[model samples]
Target: MARTVRDANPDSRTARARLEPRGKPYFRNLEPGLHLGYRKAAKGAGKWVARHCTGEQAYEVETLATADDFSDPDGLAILSFRQAQERARERMVQRAHAAAGKTSPLTVRDALETYLDFLDANRKSGLDARHRAGAFIYPPLGEIEKLTTAKLDKWLTGLAKAPPRIRSKAGAEQRYRVIADDHELFRQQ
Candidate 1:
């Protein structure tokens, strides 16, 4: 006599077939994107189904429904999904770090603000007038964070060679002296 398999639940119209490799069966009305597989442990254990995505790389991700059923096939699929997710997360973090590394060390706007603040602080302290003027012309010579010493020296060199603004003879002499004094101080340090 031939064996006939009837529906497990007579009240339900769904027809299930046992998937091979493991005998778990899937319902005939299974939703799209579902890949049915079987569990290894129990004969009556439910089917394992995973969702599929299309891209340059294809991988199976077991549906959340199968998480509680830790049979061999489901376990493998879940592990693969977790590994993919972790790799993607790591790549994103690395990309963020690389992007940050490419930005300039000191922004011009920030450097300008720091230089102005240095001038104001020195003026209030009754520092030498020549030093104050030199600090004004070479804004970066004073204490300005993030501007490297080499960059400040370059700015000062440009100022020394550039023509001075015409003013009273005494004022011009004072400006030249300030520049000369600053040059000496920078060399000594």
Candidate 2:
């Protein structure tokens, strides 16, 4: 397995404590224009952020998650140093995809269908994939060019956190229900 080299300062909590709190984040350049940032506050643990240079002087910035300095990492809202860096890179890639989507006229639904067609021709599990995608991915995703990371995250989190469905046989028909779960009403989501 390949091992990743850790950064010196931001990768360590002890090293971070030596730095002062400020509005601007301490940045480590991942590439020519992409940077991962740690923004420390005076009262609590810092947040992980990412910066992407768009043009000559323009840049895009986004806060990723809370640093796992005072608490254990959760891999979601709270992130370890390495996790933060990985999330930063993922966000940058998503941004690039969104930018590319601006010129493409295809919607997400169209892409999914096209992929399904390809899978059906090339793979044996295409029917299963089509059913699963239709049940899960195809509904909420509409005629949009690109889905934001936040939307995708929320949709996946909702699926993970949703309560188990309760199935009951009534007369000759079988029905699935979520007991006291808010997602019961929006099962297609």
Best by TM-score: 2
Error of 1 at 29 (Å): 57
In candidate 2, which residue ranges exceed 4 Å CA deviation? Answer: 1-8, 102-189
Query: Which candidate tops lDDT?
Result: 2
Candidate 1's error at 147, in angstroms? 3.9
Ten-residue stretch with the least lDDT total in model 2: 165-174
Q: How well does model 2 score by local distance difference test?
A: 0.82
Candidate 1 at 48: error in angstroms? Answer: 33
For each of the candidates, the C-alpha root-mean-square deviation to the true structure, in angstroms, is: 19.1, 14.9
- For model 2, residues 1-189, the per-residue Cα lDDT tens digits are 999986538888888887789999998998877898999899799999999999887988899999987999999999998999889887777777788664446788878887889999999988998877866687777566778998899889987876654554544443445454367657755
Stretches of candidate 1 above 4 Å error?
1-108, 112-146, 168-189
Q: lDDT score, residue 155, model 1? A: 80
lDDT, candidate 1, equals 0.42
